[model samples]
Target: MLGRLDHVALAVPDLDAACERYRSALGARLSPPKDLPDHGVRVVFVELENTRVELLEPLGTGSPIARFLEANPAGGMHHICYEVADLAAARDRLVGEGARILGDGEPKIGAAGKPVLFVNPKDFAGTLIELEEA
Candidate 1:
């Protein structure tokens, strides 16, 4: 059902400062930042051997990340992304098994130009689940 732990997304107030923190203090180099209009957020990917870390910050007040930050003052892990072989199939299985899809239908182009889908935590035990087909 899942391939690997693709990435862990962190919701931050400032993307640049966060990237700098990861790079300078943590000795990490992010690939590049990308703006995702659909999600209304900018993201930077910290590439690793088998996985990556995604830094996500809201681009506007209406952005989902912004809303999440508002509720969670100390924004931390936003979601855990899992690599999937077939996104459509995985989505169907989850829905059939009673998991609610946070986003409609198929996945859309998200941060870093990757296809991404969000599943409601209600069905996933309070964890925002992200599925990315590799």
Candidate 2:
């Protein structure tokens, strides 16, 4: 089951410019940019009182964010993450409810270094959903 909102992700063409804009215009403090090679993204988190905003840029070949950006040249919201108390249980329950899990249906280490799984967008009204173990 869903625990709480974790972070909303945005695919950005330029990570530095996105971070700078968030910092300067929105007055948001950001975490240091991190390269997640396995996930194929470079990310920076905009700290907030209630939740975090994740800015993602494509890292290497076959990056999903890169494909997303290609279709949306201006870049846009990518996905939203929710915390789950038990990732495996959540995955099973979601599967039982006919929701399709992305990837190989296994959890991956997320930006927060927690086990995470993505539910297919087709199963969630076109919004890619990430479930991170709380």
Candidate 3:
């Protein structure tokens, strides 16, 4: 099962601008943005009350965020990641429920180089769900 709301990820067109906007809106400090070359995106973490909001901006044309923005027209909430006690078990449950995983298996390094897994929206009610080990 899910542990807590680990973070909420947003797809943005400009990482720096989003960081400034988040800082101004939340009055919270910004964690240095990290470039995730593998995913072709950069991210900044804004620490909130108990969870951090992650701003994601594509680094290049091949970035998934870029494609997402193109398809959606407006960059917005990308996904909701929940910290789980056992990611493997949670994945198994999802699979058992007829969910299709976006990746091969298990969590892998994603934005911020954090271990994360993407579950297909088709199986999760049109919302891309991310599962991370607690």
Name the best candidate (by TM-score): 2
What does each candidate score in C-alpha RMSD? 1.8, 1.0, 1.8
Winning candidate number (lDDT): 2
How do the predictions measure up, each by TM-score? 0.88, 0.95, 0.88
Q: Residue by residue across 1-134, what tens digits does model 1's lDDT show?
A: 88999889899988888988899998997977888777788989998877888888998558989998898766789999898998889989988998898857678766546677899888888999989888
The TM-score, computed over Cα atoms with residue i paired to residue i, of candidate 1 is 0.88
Which residue segments of model 2 deviate by more than 4 Å? none
Candidate 1: count the clashes. Answer: 0
Candidate 1 stretches with Cα past 4 Å from truth are 112-114
Please give, for residues 1-134, the per-residue lDDT of candidate 2 as tens digits.
68999999999999999998988898999999999998899999998999988999999999999999999989999999999999999999999999999989999888778999999999999999999999
Q: Give the TM-score of candidate 2.
A: 0.95
Report the lDDT tens digits of candidate 3 across residue range 37-96. 778888888887788888888886688889888987668999999888887788788889
lDDT for position 6 in model 2: 98
lDDT of each: 0.85, 0.94, 0.82
